[model samples]
Target chain A: MELLLVRHALALPPEGEGEEADHLRPLAPRGVRRFRKVVRGLRGLGVKLDLIVTSPKRRALETAEILADLLEGESWVSSHLAAPPSEALLAELPKEGRLAVVGHEPYLSELLVWLLLGDFLGQSALGSLEDRFPLKKGGVAWLEGEPRPGGMVLRAFFPPKVFRI
Target chain B: MRDARAWVEHLRAHLPVALSGKDPEGVHQVRVAGRRLRVYLDLLGWRVLRDDLRRLVQGAGRVRDLEVVLAGPWALPQGFRRFLEGELHLAREALSPLLASPWTAALLGALEVLPPLEEGQALRALGRLEAKAKRRWKALSLNPSPEALHAYRRALRRVRYAKEFLGLPSRREKILQEALGNLQDLEVLLGLLEAFLSQGADREVLALKEALLVEREKNMAEALERLGLA
Candidate 1:
């Protein structure tokens, strides 16, 4: 099974903003353009997603909804991907399916490290676009095998900078 | 001694007592008793009987948790109160299918069996319990690694429960209790150490780490002494 971990696109700051920013913030203009580019790149690469799962958080849900629209599949909202993925969260993953998890950072990074390595250690660079897989906002990492807390192979990593073309 | 009909009758008699009460502590006790009985049957080498018993016990645990929720603020632990309040909202949203599950019927059926425990039987139930205890102790001593500690604890608990079930004399109960307590202390310390390691070596986290490690060593020494292995 394949698991795709996508960090949600850029979000407006939590406070001092319009109602949309308060709850279910729509993607920023730049975020939309970057997401489109990344989606096109994945399509061009012939990537197929069987399931799309996202955090209940508005930004993540919006991102996953967009991706589900683009990828043509149903998207599920999961509390498991909302925060630092715990053992309980890991235990809930479907045993046999390709899944896409669109969620927030720190947790995403922690999860990526937990998946790529057996333990929650190691840092993936997230800032620069050309560098080895860093988990930046709007970044997506394609992994293969069961969507477990551990034992995931890093198949590909795409950052927003990569979609600048 | 191996009559399936007699065994089923015995099981049915005890089921009701396990299910009649609605109190949180009472429900917990009944569920535990059912689990112990289930484990006893499992150790008797009855897989099919054991599976049925396990399903019943698991259902009781679920119902017990729900009861605690329904009882409101007093039923849960202080630390878990806030969390349970939120969970109760979710529980309300998903109560129907949960109450209607096959497991629920099995639990109610098991509870209906309780009143029969007062009756006397000719079968050598105590002897069966003795045999189960011997087997469990042997299993407990087989693996000593930290990873196997949980299994060891379970085995020890089985032995204790079997003794209680048979009303047997227990010379080792006190030692077993002490050993289990120390083991729990050690496990807590191990958890602290793991968390500290994950947080890295910052001054505050490190001080807490040192304190935990010291406590762990002290507890380990105490446990070894209690077991006569120091």
Candidate 2:
């Protein structure tokens, strides 16, 4: 199984003075354009997603929706992805085939590094990972193999800037 | 900052050069590139793509090791030279399937689909990598244990790869990794010698064992000094 961890594309800043403002903010116009190319790149790589899961945040939901439309599939929104990614999300992941996850940063980066370091569950066994492989807006990391700690390996990675479109 | 695509392209362009080189240096390049490629693929969970490359590396690695011993003070012992040369031929034969696999074309096509990285994203990745290296080195420096040294070598290799990828300054790391690598080879050779000697001792075998011990000590000392633990 391969996990395609994607960060949401660019989005407008929070307009209000409440936490909910951030939740409601949508993808910027340019983000939509750029992520369109990202979708092409995914298709170019012959990726056919078996499942698409996204955070509840507006930007992430939009990103997930875009990917779903491109793949002609449906997406599931989960609050589990809204905050920092945890091992709990592991259960949310599909048991077979390719899976794409669209979420926010710091969390996505943390999750990527932790998973690569063999501590996907953030268990104490692997101790703490001091480094992070940050994902920029619209970034994606590909990991093939099991989702268990140390079970996966990163195959390909791209941040938003990597898009030529 | 370099994007992952640029790095992948570099690897793709060099694969042919690395594969076709028959000299010691060329074979070594193939071995190194094969190892790096395998590691990168493994990290990304691309296990299927790695099998042929793994075989290529193992084959090249066996030849490289024998070449190293042949280049040493073995002084052209005709029997040993013939023995190693025959082994090198066998090792090279193991690589034919991989060479004929159209691997480069397939790999390049796969890599083209990778997402681009942000400006300075490479820098950030290297920064985090540097920090990880420092943390590991600090821990190993304090411990001075066998397991710690092994762990440190692993981190050093990571730092070395990141440095190579980003074109960062890595003279210290390069030297340290090289020395540590030699130390490992010597350790393995010594173990083999010990096992052979345990079976039965010849004057030539005993002399080679002594030479390997001296080389191992020298390599270990050099590695430790470079690591700042000596």
Which candidate gets the maximum DockQ versus the true structure?
A: 2
Candidate 1 achieves a global lDDT of 0.56
Please report, as a residue range, the 10-residue window in candidate 1 chain B with the lowest summed lDDT. B114-123
Tens digits of per-residue lDDT, candidate 2, A1-165, equal: 988999999998988877667776778999999998888887877888877776656678668756774443435545566666667777767767888888887777767766677644455533344334768888899998887656789999887666565
Model 2 segments more than 4 A misplaced = A1-165, B3-21, B35-56, B73-80, B112-114, B119-124, B135-151, B178-185, B188-202
Interface RMSD of each: 19.2, 15.4
What tens-digit string does per-residue lDDT give for candidate 1 at B30-138?
4566566664443333222244456445656555555554463322233333444554345433533433443334333322322222213312444455465556545
| DockQ metric for all predictions | 0.01, 0.03
What is candidate 2's lDDT per residue for B65-90, written digit by digit as tens?
76676675445435445656776667
Candidate 2: true contacts recovered, fraction: 0.00
CA RMSD of each candidate after superposition: 21.7, 16.6
